[model samples]
Target: MSGLIGKKIGMTSLYNADGQALACTVIEAGPCVVTHVKTQDTDGYQAVQLGYGEKKEKRTTKPLLGHFKKAGTTPKRKLVEFKTFERELSLGETLQAADVFVEGDFIDVVGTVKGRGFQGVVKRHGFGGVGGQTHGQHNRARHPGSIGACSFPSRVFKGIRMAGRMGGNRVKVQNLRVLKVLSEQNLIVVSGSVPGAKNSFLILDK
Candidate 1:
């Protein structure tokens, strides 16, 4: 289970050998520095903590600054721990996109979806609403009808799907085929759309 921190660089189309256009999401992956190597004896688990993206020293906390200093790396914006790395790595070592992924590799991407703030059932839960514009229905076409039962059970059931805040959730997109890897640019092109908006941080793992 090798993984890297990345940012969604946006979407683009690629032409295959057959001249068919393939939609793909471009990600700027890695160039991550290993900040810490946790061992079973020290931390009860084996994992590698990697740091990616630059951060201003003033914005970094004292504790984190010390941690980065110990690793001999500059401040980083994102830190993530990954278990089961492909190879043993030492602190301060760098991991690039090409080191972990290759074209035709299947990987999983985890990211936070774009936030939609407050949303309606029609948009959030795919509810069809009232379904008709007639039958004395005017502004109720998009309303969620009948949320509760008659006096007996009376209350809305727990875990009922209603409109509220949507998106901005951690989502995992699995089995995304790696279409291309630009090692020099630390970029990877993956098949299909991934979670989150452009420039959003993501975790790419295999």
Candidate 2:
């Protein structure tokens, strides 16, 4: 599947062709550079590495500096590899949002979700805790009740669903419609809420 790398620029409402106001998330999609192209014979695969977002030279390391220098491009904050794309891509080629997708195209967006740290079972796993609000139940309302057997196992299982750190995982939302593509500004307005917060990296694929 072909795709483009982008950054979430926040949400806004825009008018459709029918004059209906639609809520959308405005994203600053590519104008990305094809940093490297992997060939089947050489790299044992076919893929293109796209570079997005700019960064200062001081923020880049020596090894990355060398890599970007070889590609004849400035340092980018994110570099993502995309497989299953159209064949015969060359290095240093510029990819824009207009070229990858247009209005009404269906795409899959991949991003990392916002992190929620150290949560309880109720919030994390949607566990309906013991006791009702009508009854005078104590402070054990949202707690995880009785993890396991005591004398039988004597220890907690390895894969117990205890609450801890949540979110911050890679999520792919499929079949989202591209509402509009602003070519001049390199922006794209997609139909629904995407994963992650504003300014987060997003990968849009077919």
TM per candidate comes to: 0.97, 0.88
Model 2, residue 204: what's the lDDT?
A: 85
**Tens-place lDDT digits, model 1, residues 68-88:** 999999999999999988789
lDDT of 2 by residue, 55-129 (tens): 999999999999888888999999989996665677888888988887999899999999998899899999999
Best by lDDT: 1
Model 2: colliding residue pairs? none
The TM-score obtained by model 1 is 0.97
Off by over 4 Å in 2: 14-22, 133-136
lDDT of each: 0.95, 0.89
Candidate 1 residue pairs that clash: none
